[model samples]
Target chain A: MRLWLPPVLLAVLLCGLSAGMPALEPLFHWVQPDKQQVIYERESFLFLLQNHLLLVLISAAVGTLVAVAGGIFATRPSGRDFLPLVSQVASIGQTFPPVAVLALAVPVLGFGEAPILVALMLYGLLPILRNTLAGLEGISPAVKEAARGMGMSPLQVLVRAELPLAGRVILAGIRTSVTINIATAAIGSTIGARTLGDPVIAGLVNGNTAYVLQGAILIGLLALATDSLFEALERTWDRRFSPQVAV
Target chain B: MSVSRSESSQLMPNRVIPALGLLALALVWLLDVGTIQPNRIVPGTGHGLVSAVGWGGAALVTSTLAGSILLAFLNLRGRYLIQLALLGLSLALLPLLLDVFASRHLPEDSPFARSSIGAGFWCLLFFLFLMLIETLGRLGSRRGLELLLVVVIGGSWLIFLQSEGLESLSLVREFNARPAKFEQAFWTHLALAFGAVAISAVLAFGLALKMMRSPGWQRPILGLVSFLQTIPSLAVFGLLIAPLSALVAAFPVLETLGIRGIGWTPALLALVAYSLLPMVRNTFVALTEVPENLADAGRGMGMNERQLFFKLKLPLALPVIIEGVRITTIQAIGLTAVAALIGAGGFGSFIFQGLGQAAMDLVLLGALPTIALALLADAVFTMLAASLKPTPATA
Candidate 1:
């Protein structure tokens, strides 16, 4: 019998069967209806989870568009000189601390979700940008020239000729951005953006180790799950679309 | 050479137009800030003709820039717009540096305190104008200019944070400030972590060199390092605590040798351990790709293995090794921020402080510096890697 360790464990983590989401609220809260004292509800937990996921998806989608376009730009002759510039810019995005990025952008964008989205997008850009550049550069010039000589449009060459060849490397970029985004999304929750980090942050403050564990494990599991899933998708994509790609 | 100079000179006017455009925009912001009534707290102002001018000017500048960028894309214009932007930014920062960082350090109510805005504009504008001129000037290398800009930006901030920086400068001050908890707290944790990575870099370099020469040892060691990286950084820290604690118990000397704890020591050691795989693997790859025929030629010349490793392989491998270092340093910076989770502190002092207080501003104070540190480290690495490559003149 074949045993699948990663899938089995990942499933358990996601199901919150073996490990559960963490507690976020203080031990007591004043109820909205009767002013009676109570703990925070399950509703806040759900809100955090939903917002966290939304931030991740939006950031990653923005990242993909920018990276792919950047990749294409990097492949052009004049843009070739911009590799260092683009890399440096992305690193700045990486370097401009997320909190600082929030501070810097706050005057421009204001509080809450917008700043968080900006942070994740900035952080998410580098790997995707770098990978896109690297992937496109790695494509054989001869193959590209051949595509052009055959009367194929530039778009056609990029889509059918160059991208297909660079799929694996591009996928690697996607993987890096996705994983980084997962960790960074937690930082957003700190700014009232509601994320699984609510529990973790709450737990740490109150010295409630259990609450911390609940948040930490779920977030960790989330990262691991994305990592594994993307990795699988990468492998599958490579096998199907570019059969000749070296594993 | 003569032809190249002529070609570059032809590129001069391409630089000038955009630079002028940026200056014009800066003038507009200046007018806006000067003439507009201030809300003080809100940037870009809340109302009045100045506010209108402030935003209007900003929109116009953005469009001009976008236009310039579009021209570059279309190969019609603005190829030099970017150069001008960096130029303006760098120049503006120099004076702004005086204002932002130096202001509060002065007597609290001094009019000179707000004069930082003047300093800000002067320095920043100078840098911008200089850069635009430089592209036309080719007066200095772009890389040098970029470094100067970063230094101007970061150095000014450092000057601003001297109080905090000086406080954390010494282990003696740090330890004496808290006797019993010396080994467990934030400052010690950061120092240990910083030390761990530095030590690990040296150790990993040696280990990598050894494994590169020996097939039997390389595979297992690489596997171990890769596996180590896969462990959640926190989990690794957790796993390490028990082993470290056990080792300290079994061999008491290890404790006095400066081994210990759920604190900085273990956290740092674990981070270093995580760091090694990338450095070692990168070093190995760099060394191995030195084209075996070069080593064969060295052997034919009767050079000893040691000489060949250093004189040829190491120099050839320097770029990749430095690239690895770049990655390691950034990773270390990020991970170091997490060191706060284990009670070890760098700038994570601000991060946790912000979290506990739920004050986002406080967290930015900590995190911004960490990000700056990471970026600065990346810049340093990039420069090192770039310098290692065979220069065009040499080639």
Candidate 2:
């Protein structure tokens, strides 16, 4: 029930801002010129929200696939030697900022979603990869031995025992990757990929506080919603995994 | 038996990867025509690699092919020397290839007809990178070989910097055009990154200590910092603009002190805000991770709360705290580039300008230096964290 509070509050704030509530006008009053006021209505909030969600979803899905593949490969007997290399590559991926990636990628991939997608995927890779690796490596050797003793093949053990145990941690990584990508995706607008960042960029350029606030508030709400949803999912996972363990 | 199998497999040279790489490079050079193109002045009308570099290019290609063949035959013991030599030769070929292409294809006075690095060039670079990685893996901890390679590469880069062959490259031209501006931007970038780190360290440490003392404040303070972390940097910059402007308008004195809606003031504030989470979280974990028995022992010895904190908690937590500092500093350095969007002067100015101009080299000119700075900061902080770490007690 407490989880609903954030979204409810966010909805109310959005409504008030969209309605241009007199109470909220003072918040943006400083942005006005002498004896003049301006209201921002440049882009549709719903459209921006959808665009932002789409970018995050696409990037997170791709990043998850790549990171999980790399993570799984590194944990394998033959591939264990590549763990340090994989980890270093992922860290370097993160160290280069998403904006720098966008800047560099724009030339090769050209502008729009391609470059932004590349940036977000690279930016989102580290958390998912690191967490996935950690989660897999954290599994006890006893569990593996037990599964093997029960006549399970390596693949069967991995699927039935190992992955299930690592599921929550991997899910947490995906959650972190997706949530961070939500904010980082805003940079996509700089390279002509329209998202919630349009207003933020527009406001920065034109000095329209209303536009900035509107975009920021919507993005903040979206991030909060995503975070809370992940929290709820985590709680559910926890409940399922250990009924005896108290919340 | 498994160990022997693995050891034997490891000892056998992995020639396939490097050979495959060389094959790709050879195929690109031979079959993939139009590898060198005139800089995209009028879209795409450039000659093939052979015509671009003429006879000298063929000789260079043959040499590289021979080197790769030699690399495949050589055992692990003697491979490092050959790999190092091949790597140096490959590095030298880049500028030579460019220079030859420019001289052959483009007329001397036709500035617009400059040679551009093409798909073939990129393919060669990819091959070189693979070879370097493979060699590094095989060489293991031959520190002397690594040092010699670095010195050779560094010396070659220095020579490349002075050579006119690189003059036609757009990145060099951009640098040559605005050397002073680039210098200023570099310093400004350094200042913003380091200055923000210094301020955030103090604030984060104070908040962390406060949160440690008061359990009630922990949830709210940590939540707030985490929430702030979620705010995209641009949005944070935007959010700060109005309030900061209003503050300057109201105070008037702040404006005199160089506080304004846009620039370093907001950039620094946003950076400090972003930095607080990692710093506070690390500090909190570090402080808590210190054994309760130690603190209790300190208290039992008649040490006051202040003494317990200063003498026991802090010293124990210092390494982790320094780790946090390292993380925050590296993060801040990377982020300061974004701060340029808000009129704050930094390397980002060049990045954005390059973006506007659609100049890849200009973007690189801004970006390369920023990446170098982040790496430098990372190395320095890593050393600091290592030196500060408490050594394990002898048995």
Candidate 3:
């Protein structure tokens, strides 16, 4: 229960801040004294927040499924021949800057949510795939052999033994993937995706510090909320799975 | 031995390379290989492989793919070596194919007319590179061979891109328009990315030392740095604006020193902040993970603590520390591009400006170099780390 507290509090703060941004106009006026309209009015902070979350959520779901499946395939005996290339691709793909990937998508797919979605999915999968490989490969051959000796089939052993053992690291990979997707989704606003970055980009263009601050605070809070949620999850996983290990 | 030989032979016909070959063959004919534009803003006419570069070029591409696929079925000794040579040659000369496309399809009369790479060309280049990686891995090639390949191919592309035939390529045209700005962006990007890495390396070293001396300090410092990293780059840049502008307002002297609210200052701060997690974590682990016996041996030699650190521990830790630097440098290069949003003036300025104007080639002009810089940094630092590692027997 205590482990869950931080994430809950952070989520509440994120929601409160997003909904209450307009009420703080007097404060924003002080931040930007010369501007006639200090508050960002083109889009509501809540709607932008929702859109940003939807983009990240959809990409994260699809990226996880694809990356995990790819990792499993590469590790299996049937797909063993491709493991080297797959791992190489996973690591090398990360060297690409996410912003460059996002930019490149615009030329090929044009400006819209679709391009950003594809970019997020592709970029987000790399880290997850790398971690999935690392996690699954880190398991010892002896463990699998023992499971086989116990008369369990390969599919049964994989589902019952291998995946459970690798789940913690896979969760860590998901955490990393989500964190990056959040940041990239914010930048997606520049490519015509409606996101929290809308206010920040608009503020930068118009030289309105208030709008910038509002967007920045919300983005910062969203990231914090998401990170803390992952922290609580990792702690729960650790406690439930590895009670013998010290924190 | 006989059973193992049989099993290995059964696995002989490599499936990955042939599959990639088939995909490339399809894409090269199915998709546009290049596009010819009359001007910067308008959409261009798409050209297939034969239309863009003639049947000769088309035959050359088809033959390369067909040959790579055919070689996989040969079951001959040293097959991977032959495949490597063939693919490496093809990859090294890929830019000339584009040059051919530009020379053939580009309108000679219109100064504004330019040609850009299309999906098929990108697919061909990508599939060829994948095949090369597979072949290299199968051959268990030496690091020297890989480096030689990179240098040869990179040099070839540089020469071809700068050649007269490709002058009408849209990416080249964009660079030609603002050569001075391109140079400045290059320098600014190098300075900002490396500057942040250097600063954080020193600060993280100090922090790591402190954590080593007092274990209680470790959690709080790591926590703060990771927290800084979790915030999006734009938000960090945005968050820094208010306080920085207010500070400059309060201290007018900072304006003359070029410390603004939204330029390189905030960018440097944010980059340095983000760099700390990897830098400190690696430094701390590297220093602490040094074997205890080595230090005792140094003490047995009557060396003081400082001498033991400088002579024994630091040298052992250097490779891991350099590994951390590699990660930080690649990350900083990417973030520096994002920092352009806050007026830091790097390659990202070109990306954003191009996006604003809907100029795809200009965006490539920014993005391609950033990716190249990252790949270069990755290669250099990887080599440096490998070279710094003490051999197992010696250690």
lDDT of 2 by residue, A33-136 (tens): 54244445565566677788888998899989998888998898877756755665566556665567667777557778878888888878788998888888
Q: Could you give candidate 2's per-residue lDDT for residues B281-333 as a string of tens digits?
A: 99889988999998999999999999988988898899899889888887887
C-alpha lDDT (0 to 100) for residue B322 of candidate 3: 99
Displacement of residue B395 (Cα, Å) in model 2 is 5.2
lDDT of 1 by residue, B1-395 (tens): 46576445445344333544565555535532221112212222222212332444446445654454333333423344455454444443333323322322333443211111222233334334433543433333566555565566557645643444222212123233444543333454346546766877898888887886688998899987865665455445444554566578799998777777445676678778868977888988898898888799999999999999888888888999988887877777777766566556666655665555644344545665566577667777888898888554545
List the candidate 1 regions with Cα displacement exceeding 4 Å.
Answer: A1-9, A16-54, A73-87, A95-113, A241-247, B1-193, B206-210, B213-224, B227-263, B355-361, B386-395
Task: Give residue B315's error in model 1 in angstroms.
Answer: 3.5
TM-score of chain B of each: 0.63, 0.80, 0.95
Check candidate 3 and list the clashing pairs: none
Off by over 4 Å in 2: A4-30, A33-37, A242-247, B1-10, B15-75, B78-96, B112-127, B130-151, B291-316, B393-395
lDDT of 1 by residue, A68-173 (tens): 8986875676555445455545555565544445444443355578877887787787788887878887877888898999999988998888888877887888
> TM per model?
0.70, 0.86, 0.97
DockQ of every candidate = 0.21, 0.43, 0.86
Q: Looking at candidate 1, what is the lDDT of residue A105?
A: 47
Candidate with best lDDT:
3
RMSD of each: 8.6, 4.3, 2.4
| Residue pairs with clashing backbones, model 2 | none
